[model samples]
Structures are given as structure tokens and as C-alpha cells.
Target: MKKLPIILSLLFLTLCCVSCKVGRFVYYNLANITDYKIFPSRPLVNDSIVFHYYTTEQDKAKVPKKINYNGSEVAFDDFLADNKTVAFLIIKNDTIQYEKYFNGYEQESIIASFSMAKSVTSILIGCALDDGFIKSVDEPVVNYVPELKDNGLEKVTIKHLLQMSSGIKCEESYINPFGDAATYYYGTDLRKALSKMKPEREPGTEFSYSSCDTQLLGLVLERSLKGETITEYLDEKIWKPLGMEYDASWSLDREKNGLEKTFCCINARARDFSKIGRLYLNKGNWNGKQIVSENWVEESTKPDTGLGNVDYYKYQWWLSSGGSYMAKGLLGQFIYVYPSKDLIIVRLGKNYGEVAWPELLTSLAENY
Candidate 1:
């Protein structure tokens, strides 16, 4: 009888809170892999003309049977299994060398991209540039979003947001129920969350990784579009052109007429995710066609040590210490690319576990 009263109290409080972002966060608990089902999504329907890459399992490269990890040696297959990986793929020369799925996950199972969507957003930004929807990266963000002038964001640039040096004030903690990440993830109105944005310091002053930068970029992308949503733009430019094997969807802030959570939440299959790797591996050229400018692809992945920028990251893509880069996300999701060896590694997991994947991937690339 006492527990019933407590439960009813929580229910009443949840029903009464404005927006209910906090209540939704508590109700859903922490973010998980299958979030696609919990949230309504904008469909990313693939092209009718699909591109399929054949697999050559027998011609797979030799990987160490026993892998060394954080000073301890473990069986190579067991290592990925123990880390709760749902999908793992190693592609060489435009073919699948190794593919595995575990923990009730299959090849066709849909997996949420988490922050890997940031990299996809970066690609869309490049397309926006090519199509003349956006003039240049150096332009002040306020040119696209004048309403943010009073918020002290007039000095911020599109490049600044891409580089994560926008100096936007946001609490990035996923554990905090009141934090910006949780609110953005669970909130019904993304524009409402964006309207409350406040700057903490001068943009381009220091390197700071904030989801607010990416979310703001989404709004800019949204505003720049003529007669479409970001999801429609993605479908027309990337998904349909690239010929994705399956239909995917971008999760929205609401079930109907909502903006894409571009900072995260692109739900897709494993092989289809690898196609993104193949695109960049070919330097944004799919077959003989140029999907994005070659210069844009180079700038997006290459290290930049300029002021207020990081050599380890550029244009929402993470650069390795070596000649490799990745589209990384929360919970250890990765689209690691090693161009020197023509290798691409996709690892999607419940958590990253003990491995520092960037370093490990660098070492793994050396063998190829």
C-alpha cells in the first residue's frame, strides 16, 4: 500500500512536469543500444538501386589468434565477445575479411549510431557546401541564425562548431538527469533546448568537445535547407546515392514533425555502416562518381594543429596519431578507417570496455 502511493506520486510528478524531459530520462534510465524502438525516427530509405559488396572470407587476412590487450593476452575472437560487441567487421580491399555478431545481434539487426551520426552530419555539411546551400565555413553562424545574436553566438563560425571549439556552455554528462545531453536526448523540442543556449567564453579560444556545437550545427543545417528536413537531405545526397543495402532512419526529438538528433541517433545495420567507411576510403568517390569534394574528405580526416583546433580531431571525425581516422560514438561505436593499408574496422558495442580502440586499431592496422 505504501509502495503504491510512492509510485502514484512519481506518476503524478511525471505527468505534471513541463516538457517532461527529466521525467522521461528517469523513466528510460541510461541510454542503450536499442533506443531506436523507444524513440520515433525519421526514415532514411535506401536507394532502389542498391550496391552490394561481395565477401571473401577464405581470402581474409591473417589476424593474431591470441591478441594482446592492455598487457594481458586473450584470444582474438574472445576479446570482442567479452566486450559485448554486437557487430564487428574488418574490410580489406573493398571486401569483408571478417564479420561477427554476438549477444543476440545479427548482421541485419538495426544498431543505433550514437555520436557516429556526428560524422554523418559532417558529410551532409560538405554536401551542403557543394550544392551552394552554405557559402563557406568561415562565415559567422549568426548569418544563418540571427536569433542567436543576443546569446553571444554571433562570433561563432560553422567551422568552429565542426571543430568543437564553439565555446558553447553545456553539461555533457549522460548520467546527470538535468544535463544537456539527457535533455537533448529525451526532450520533445530540440529548438527549445537550443533557444536556451548560452556561451561561456569566446569561441575559437580553446578546444572544447561539446554536443551543443553539433546540435547547433543541426539547426544551421535545418535552416539552410530549402524544402526538406536534414533527413531528406541525407537520403537524397548520401543514402540514395551511396546505395545503402537497407532502409535506415534518423531518430527525431518527437514522433511527428521533429528535428533530427544529429548529434546522435542514426540507426542502421553493420554492413551498411561499412559503406560509409568505403566512401571515405575511396576519398568520397563511390565508383567513378564524386559524392563529396575530394578536398572536403581530405580536410575532414587529416590532422589540423591550427589555433583553437585539435590535430586529433577535425570536422567531427577523430584522427588517429597515424594515417587513420574514425567516426566514433558513445558506448564504443566506431567506424575506424586505415587508409594506408586499405582497411576499415567497424565495432559496435554495449560499452567500449578496457580497450582504447584508436590505439588498438592503429596497432591492428600495422599487421595488414
Candidate 2:
């Protein structure tokens, strides 16, 4: 019966193999908790966070002018009905004429911006450039975040990363459980998660969206101003200066630093978010203060020099052929702006993954 020991060992080995497979899956799916929640409330307004509120007089003057558009009311209703559009705001000529919050949402409710944060990053870059904190977009990314110097990603430029052409291979499917995007979120340190990737193409050659590209940009921002974090920089340079009326919160990494460069998760009042768009509409000038340079605004909105369509991507912001630009986030979070029309629209919802946002935009464009 010596074969009994062999059989038992085989059984133990099989069990161990199965356990290891299960453990790997768990590792891939599980996210560590520095802090996490399904629908977390945003921080209250104070010195750390502030919101921009419209006074009664300002509100009266800021109402939008009516427009004659060809889109049907029924179609819009259908969009809201079928899609999980939690918040929608339409600003025309720097005024709020149409604003709404659905799905148990309110005026002060904080919603995740998802990738919309990238546009915010673009603005921060503009401010840095305007302040002479950063010399140019064409500078090698390693110039800011020196730790990336020896890595293959050293070839990537700030401009390339902004345009989503950093040449890093990435899969950005959030719905897929085992996807790289999902795996990155599950990691204990999302910032460090990016350094594990390899460069797949020549920097600025083709368009391939990579969250890691933006994460690396965050690293650059963190390194740029000595020991200052991105959140602190944004608060001093952007958020506080704009006089945001809400205390917006950003999800952090293991280092407790704001992931400012991409996958935006700031939660602010609808009007506060619009203020940012307003700042851009005015070419980075805010209340006589040039928070960011006029030249930087012009360049950020322009098309990239790389392979992709200039209309599709512009300095980490997306500009349409109609001269309109947007802060687009996954699941239908959008801060849409049209300079010619003086229009700014903000929508926060879960319809992005399942609904056709482009179709809605087309209808709105044709109608408005």
C-alpha cells in the first residue's frame, strides 16, 4: 500500500494547484482599502475645499437665451429614461438656463468624473506653463519625473502623454473583470501600478488610450514643484483661486496624493464644475486674474501634432469639429463647452457605458 502515499500527495498537489489559481483571480480582482466606497459623499466646503456659488443678482443675469433647435423633446426624454443620467446642466452664453439632477442626485451631490479628470489635468498643465513652473509641453516627461528616466517610457514626452499617445500598451475596459484598467484599480498603489507596463510603440506615433500615461503625468506633477503634491498645487492654483463653492474630493493613491493627471474623480457642485469651463471659455482669465495663460489655453484646445485626428484629441482635452470641447468621463460624465455659443453643459450619469452619448450630442448640436 505504498501507492497510498503517492495518491494522497497527488490529491494534495491538485488541491494546491486549484487554490493557487483561485488566489490569483482574487489578487486580480481585489482592491486594497486606503479608502473606498460605492457612492461616497464629498467633503464639506471649508478652507481646504470651496465652491463657487452664483449670487441672486448674478443668477438673474446669467440665465441662458432660448434657442431654436431641431431635436425632439421625446428623444431627450427617452435618453434620460433609458440612460442613468443623474445630473444634466446646460449653460448658454455663460448662463445656466437648463440644469437638472436625477437618480436621487441634488445640487451639491458629488459624482465621480472618471476620465473627465484628464481635462482638469490639461488645465493644471496650462497653469503650470503660464506660471513658468513648466517650460513647455514638448519637454521630455523624464525632465519632471526623473524616476522614469531609465525606463523605456523615458521616450514619452509631456505632449505625447497628454494626447494619449505615450506608446504604452494598455487595455481600458472597466466592465471586464480581468482587464488592465480594472487590475490597476485593485492594486494597493495605483501610481506604482503604471511603472510595470512596457512601451509598445514610438511615442506620439498612434492613438492608444492608456490610464498609465496620465498616472505618469501625475508622477511628473508630484515631482515638478519639489515635495508639493498634485492636490495641493491644484487647490492653490486652480480650485481655490476659482472660488469653488464645494469641497471636492479626489481618490488617492497609497501615497495619499491626488491622482490629478487622469481618471478624474473630483466631486463638486454642478455650478462649480461649470466655473472651470467658464475659466477656459475666457481663455484662462478669471476675474482679472490670469490663472493660466491665454497662449496656453489656445494651445491646449488646438489639435495635437501626432497621428490622431486633431479634432478628436487636443492637449488631453477632446475637441469636436464644431469648435466645441469636452471633459468626457466614463459612464456619461461630461462637461461640454462651445466657445462660439458661450455654452457649457455638464452631465453626470451611468448611461455612458450602455447609451449613445454621441447621438445625443448630435441631436443637441443640430437642435441648439
Candidate 3:
């Protein structure tokens, strides 16, 4: 009977993990492009309305299809396929100039764009501001999510979260199972998990790329929504208005009426994601119906370093010095827009795969 106690202890620990996110983390290994497949999600359903892009034979433009990578010349399509690219698209003048799918993916297949959801959340925030759900950017987050006041987040403004300058600290690593990333990504109760969060310093001093800042923005949005879920808000403001061709989903911290992870996890198909790039490319107007305010879109994609912020990141969108910007995510998901060329490029990959994607996109926008 000596081994009975030890066996029981091991059994207990195993059960505890099995009942929680740790078991999921162990099963999934590191976060992957497929993480959304295993998580409980909220549906963003579409109505009968749909918008089709303008296309023509002449709309498709030709460009350099061969490039030297790693000191060897390879076909650009082969290079993309070998480098884990699943879906790629180039849209110009509201038409799909080029579209390709590799690795057994199709236009109907779903891919999770982690952190690209941050830009979408910022869009919703802008919508809320326009709708009077949120007063202004300068308003403190505690005004919406009063629960955060206990963590000394009262000084943190909506702008701080949008700019990623909120000094509130959480471990940013995605590979660590016990870290905040895992806790927020896989935990069952985000409401409960949030109370454990504490600020590393006072608000809005230096730029820090923390997913926690984005989740806090999600929480603030949730509270201010007033009897509506975040998913519903997105559908009403974006999906329906943009006439997204396929239905998409947003990951939640739990299965039923749970808080959206909101820092990440907007599961969608590649073509549908292109519409986002298209939206910003036209400065947030979709077919003459303003989706988000033009002023908001300009503020989001513009490069600014003032107020302790980085020039490359503004309002949850990434900017380049030459007036290009993108919504980027882990595992190489991108919705790149170059307004100067009237081009929008979308790439969804399993991983970055030894390619500096931003530079490549810049080259394509400039030369193609």
C-alpha cells in the first residue's frame, strides 16, 4: 500500500491539468496557425448581403516572378510554397490581380490570423467612438472597465492601449505555457484571470508590445458595449457592412458567453481578409458607405513617434516610413496595404520560413 499515496497524488495532478488550459497547451505544443481549430469560438454570421470585387483581364498586372533567395534563383511561386505560404493574394483597384493557395488550402479553408485581430479591435473601438459608445480616446479605460481600477490602471487611456504604449506588464512570450500569453489564450475565465494582472509602471510612458494591453482594450470595449457582445458589434459594424463573402469566427476564452481573447484569434479565410486590406486601402470607406471614419483610419495607419510611441506602430496597425502599413500576425499572416500604388496584398502562412516578409512586400509594392 506504500505506492497508493504517490499514485493518488499523480492522479490528482493529472486530473487538475486535464480540466484546465495546461492540458491543452501540452497537447498543442507551441501555438500554431491551427490553434483556432481547437478553441471555443463565437460566430460572426453573415446575412444575405455580399460584395464582389471588380475584376477584368486587364486588371491583372504582371511582374517579376523570379527572385534570388539564399543566393539561389528560384521561381517566386516555388519559393512561396517551400516557405510555408498557404494563401497569397494581390489586389489592385478593387480587383484580385493574383491569388494562389498552397499546402492543400483553398479559398474556403479557414486560417487564424493572430494579432491581426488587434487592428480589427481598433476598428471597432473607432466605431464605438463614432457611435458614442465610447466618449473619446483620451478617456481612461477605468471609465469603461471599472474593475481595472484595483490594478492601478485608472491612468491608462484608450490611446495608450491602441498605441501599445501602456506600461502595464505581462510576459509576452507565446511559447511559455505558464505565461500570460497562455493564460489569456487558453484560460477558461478571462474575467477571473484579469484580476491577477498588475501594471509594471505608470501608464503611457514607453512603447511595450504586450498582448495584455490589447486584451484590456477588449475588456473595455466589452463593458462599454451595453448589452451587446463584441462579436455582435463586429458583425454589425464590419462584417455586414463590408459584405464579407464567408462567415468567420472570433476565439473566446471559454465556450459560452465568454470573453474574446481579443489580443488575437480572428479565424477567417484569406480572400475575406483581403477585404480588410481593401477597406484601409480606400481609407475605411467601403463602396461609398463609410465603414470606419476616414480620420480614424488615417490616425491608425500614420507613423508617429510622439508621446512615447514607436513610429512603426500606431493605433494597433503597423506603418512604414514610405506610407505603407499592414495588419500583421504570428505565423506570417499579413494584410499589407500600399496606398501610393493602390495595392493590397494578403499572405497567410504556416510560419515566416526564413523570409523577411515586410521587405518582400515593400519590394513587390514598389516594383510590381
User: Which candidate gets the maximum TM-score versus the true structure?
Assistant: 1
Candidate 3 global lDDT: 0.87
- Local accuracy of candidate 1 as per-residue lDDT tens digits, 1-368: 88999999988897676357888787777899899988888898987899977687544555557787778889888998898888988888877778889888998999999999999999999999999999999989888888899888889999999999998898999999889999889989999889888898888878888888999899999989966999999999889889999999999999777999999999999989988988999999999899999999999998877868878899999998568999999999999999988899999998888778777777888776
- By lDDT, the candidates rank as 1, 3, 2
lDDT of 1: 0.89
Using Cα atoms with residue i matched to residue i, what is each candidate's TM-score against the true structure? 0.95, 0.79, 0.94
Could you give me the TM-score of model 2 versus the true structure?
0.79
The candidate with the higher lDDT, 1 or 2, is 1
**Please, what is the whole-model Cα lDDT of each candidate in the order they appear?**
0.89, 0.66, 0.87
The TM-score measured for candidate 3 stands at 0.94
Can you write out model 2's per-residue Cα lDDT over 1-368, one digit (the tens) per residue?
99999988876765564323233334334322111243222242435544333334435643334322334333443456456777777777655566767767778776667777788877877777776778888899878766666667777788888888888878876655556666454333555666576777888778877777777776766667677666677777887788777677665643344344345556566777788788888889887989888988888787765465345777777777567787887667777777877767777775553556655554465456
Cα displacement (Å) at residue 12, model 3: 9.2
Candidate 3 per-residue lDDT over residues 40-69, each given as its tens digit: 888887769888877656334564478887
Ranking by TM-score: 1, 3, 2
Output the worst ten-in-a-row residue range by lDDT, candidate 3: 55-64
Better of 1 and 2 by TM-score: 1
